[model samples]
Target chain A: MPNLYDLAYDLEKGLRESAEFQGLKQAYDAVMADEAAKQMFDNFRQTQIVLQQKQMQGEEITEEEIEQARKTVELVQQHPQISKLMEQEQHLNTVINDVSRIITKPLEELYSENS
Target chain B: MPNLYDLAYDLEKGLRESAEFQGLKQAYDAVMADEAAKQMFDNFRQTQIVLQQKQMQGEEITEEEIEQARKTVELVQQHPQISKLMEQEQHLNTVINDVSRIITKPLEELYSENS
Candidate 1:
């Protein structure tokens, strides 16, 4: 009875107001408010982005770089606020993933038998 | 008032029944019905996947490989059914991208004012 885009926006509004999103936002805000945790998270993200860029460019990433990235991840995961933020991010991702799976169903069904 | 996942399923059904998706399905089926066009399309897809895998693995793709892939693409583009399928795929992608943009709004807004 209603437009698809209208329903999409309605779903968007619902997701933004949902509990998972609220917890993610709260955790993110807490991380941002703490100077040390924020800096640690920033460094971790920088490490991740650099590695991702190398991967995207098809450049060989050395073991040393991988080790450094792992250490950076460990450091950030050790922080209470950052750890909470990461946990909350996973929760939000579950909801987002569910929506994506539903959206991609048609494409999957189309290729199911042949592909 | 309804569940977010409920609204998502509603949007999914709407998208599946939309003109863009219907057109895409029709174009795809037409390609599958023609043996010559289907074989050409399959060859093009296999070429694309091989190159994509090379890129993912950080391997050097030779210029000859690139040229071969370019020729495969040209051959597919020349086919009526495959070309129509690509055009319809683009139309469906527009609809899918719109939904994705709506769904990602919260994450965007969260990081908007910060960084």
Candidate 2:
């Protein structure tokens, strides 16, 4: 029978491989669900709607009106609520990084010992 | 000026010492706040309350009633919700343990390299 250390080593190797595959899947899902990207797309759609609404109202698109719309888009992009959410996302990323560091400690030790 | 490794080492040492102190404080607080112990004490108090309530009602306490009350106390002590909470606590402990292991990897590497 294989010793406990050998069995543990094999299990660790399998876990690392599975975790890598899972990480890739998670990254793909995150990109697909990115709130910031969705918000920006929504802002663009809203601009189109605003222009359409103005046309229906028989309002001539003036340079000043166009400039105002541009500013509104910028404001939407830089919304305080979005900024706060981004900050929270960054904080969560930090926590996840810390947790990842903790999980990888034993592997690093094993590498160092073997080397 | 200290090298990056030296600075990192000093920072790690300080963090470890602070974390150790925090862990000790948390353990002390956990012992003091033990819900199971509190529940057992409450059960004893409830028994006294029932005895008083019976005397006020002019009802004689029988051995069977006392035995039934003891079983109720046992059932309260063995509440499923408390067991579920304990399981959740154990799961959280596992996560914390995993995180701690990851965080300590670099230190273990350094130790192995120095040795």
In terms of docking quality, model 1 is: medium
Q: What is the DockQ score of candidate 2, to 2 decimals?
A: 0.01
DockQ scores of all models, one per candidate = 0.58, 0.01
The 10-residue segment of model 2 chain A with minimum total lDDT is A1-10
Q: What is the lDDT of residue A69 in candidate 1?
A: 93
lDDT of 2 by residue, B1-115 (tens): 2132332333333333443323433433343356765465355557868887886655788998789787865764475544343444355356446434543443344224312
True contacts kept of 2: 0.00
Tens-digit per-residue lDDT, B12-80, candidate 1? 888888887888999999988888888898899899999998878878899999999999989888888
Q: What is the C-alpha local distance difference test score of each model?
A: 0.86, 0.48
What stretches of model 2 exceed 4 Å from their correct place?
Answer: A1-38, A41-77, B1-115
TM-score to true structure, per model: 0.90, 0.22
lDDT of 1 at B2: 43
Segments in model 1 whose C-alpha atoms lie over 4 Å from true places: none
Report iRMS (Å) of candidate 1.
2.1
How big is the positional error of residue B83 in model 1, measured in Å on the Cα after superposition? Answer: 1.0
